[model samples]
Target: MLELTNVSSGYGETQVLYDLSVTAKAGRVLAVLGRNGAGKSTTLKTVMGLLPTRSGAISFDGATLPGKPYEVAKAGIGYVPETRDIFPSLTVRENLDLAAKRFEGSDWTIERVVELFPRLGERMSNGGTQLSGGEQQMLAIARALLMNPRLLILDEPTEGLAPVIVQQIHDKLMELKRGGLSMVLVEQNFGFATSLADDVAIVSKGQIVWTGSPAEIRADIEAQHRWLGV
Candidate 1:
């Protein structure tokens, strides 16, 4: 459903991604694994068109995404960033309402999101700042779900959350995957990655060094320690 070919991107004067090529197929989870500063997040940003690609191409659902954020989002890709990008001043209902504008099909809705994260239903009137980190994360995911995106890109969705919350998020992702949602997950938690991913792409020094099944990654202890610093 998504493809990146020989893509290179970075901040001004310092390239971070080195001809990185990756693909996330429909109805499969591609776990992108790397340590800090490994350019994993940069890859997602480039795919989302938030950062300019110095070279190469990104195509989603058979069309090349324009090098613009809105254009990419409009092309059926939803991004949930590391920061959880919720509007601090907006109520949960309002946040969800805003996302509803992007809905395309009957696959996703506020009711479905409320079922996924019941806490959001209880806090529908509360502003983003009033929600806890876990609550905010749920809100962010719920908002994305309301968009009914064909492909969901989650950047460290489990980062900094309690283990219970992480597990909850993991369960939701697995559920989505079973229901045929394509996802590219940028995850540091190997256990979580292994639980949901069909394949794993181990990245180092801004490029994909190893791409294989999750079990294959698990069996390769040397590659894990060398590239992931585990």
Candidate 2:
């Protein structure tokens, strides 16, 4: 459903991605795994048009993606950054309100997302800053769902959270996957990622070094040590 071919992008003269290529197929989850500074997040940013595609192409659902982030979102792609970029001053409901978009046949709604995330339902009136790390992460994902995206790109959904909270996030993502939501996940939690991903792409130095089924990646200890340092 989403393809980035030979894409290169960076911030002002310091190139981070080099001829990188990856694909997230329809109704499947693609996990991009890499160590820090390996340009994993850069790949997502380029695809989302947050960073200019310095070279190569990105296509979504058979069409070239627009050159703006908002356009990309409107094109049915949702991004939940690792930073959990919620408006600290806004109430939980207010944050979700900003991202709500409705169209014919849309499956996601504020009421539905709140159902998926019961914690969010209880904290609708709480300010963004008042939530815990896990709650903030839940709020971020809930807000993205409010957009009714066809493809969701999540950067480190489990980062900096307690193990129990990580499990909650993983369970919720599994529900989304079962619902046929195409996703591109960049995460450091290997077990959590591999459990949910159908395909895995290991990135090194800004380029994809290996692509395989999650089962293949899990059993290849040498590849894990060499590419992922696992």
Candidate 3:
């Protein structure tokens, strides 16, 4: 479980998030939905300590989050930035090997990840730059899972991919959900996100404007238009 309460953060002298708050419950998906520049990605960055938490608090699993990115990752939080920051020069196996971490009772393994992403298995020797957009996204997710995170934070997992690839990503995420992974997702693909998310938080101008079930958000056309521009 993760909670960000009244958190406000931003770039130097240009605040983006304003008293923002959201929660990701245990073994459930929380989708943060917003238009561009709504500060959705900023929320995740602040939580990861990539950006300083200018004000307010972020707690994970009942403890205050560490103030450094690596420490946060060690604390059982995995982040997949929207950029899918993979090492372009490294082979697929090399990239995954660098992120591999194991602990007592850890269920994620390279074998399991490859099973989840068969494409990645076949492309084990391929360089990061040689992969397609969807393959890169799969690699990113696979790398994160290798860290054995208790809570996975993904930013825009379905962005810039073909519809069929999106569906593949969606199906893989569903499998992860069924395996009881707690996830916080920020995504532009509404239908893909809503299908997987247990709850929805709509961000507007760097703050959460609404929180509801996916079904509730789907039916509220006015909220969709007003807050999400859907």
Question: Which candidate comes out best when scored by lDDT?
Answer: 3
The digit string of per-residue lDDT tens for model 1 on 24-137 reads 999899999999999999999998888899999988877888888888877888899999999999999999989886564647788889998999999999999999899999
**For each candidate, what TM-score against the reference?**
0.97, 0.97, 0.97
How many backbone clashes does every candidate have? 0, 0, 0
Answer with 1 or 3, whichever has the higher lDDT.
3
Per residue, candidate 3 scores C-alpha lDDT tens digits across 51-77 of 999999999999999999999998999
Off by more than 4 A, model 1: 104-106
lDDT string for model 2 (45-64, tens) is: 88888899999999999999
Q: Evaluate residue 88 in candidate 3 and report its C-alpha lDDT on the 0 to 100 scale.
A: 100
Clash count for candidate 1 is 0
Clashing pairs in 1: none
Q: What residue runs in model 2 are displaced by over 4 Å at the alpha carbon?
A: 101-105
Model 3 residue 67 CA deviation (Å) reads 1.1
Candidate lDDT (C-alpha), each: 0.90, 0.92, 0.94
Better of 1 and 3 by TM-score: 3
Per-model C-alpha RMSD: 1.1, 1.2, 1.3
Cα lDDT of model 3 overall? 0.94
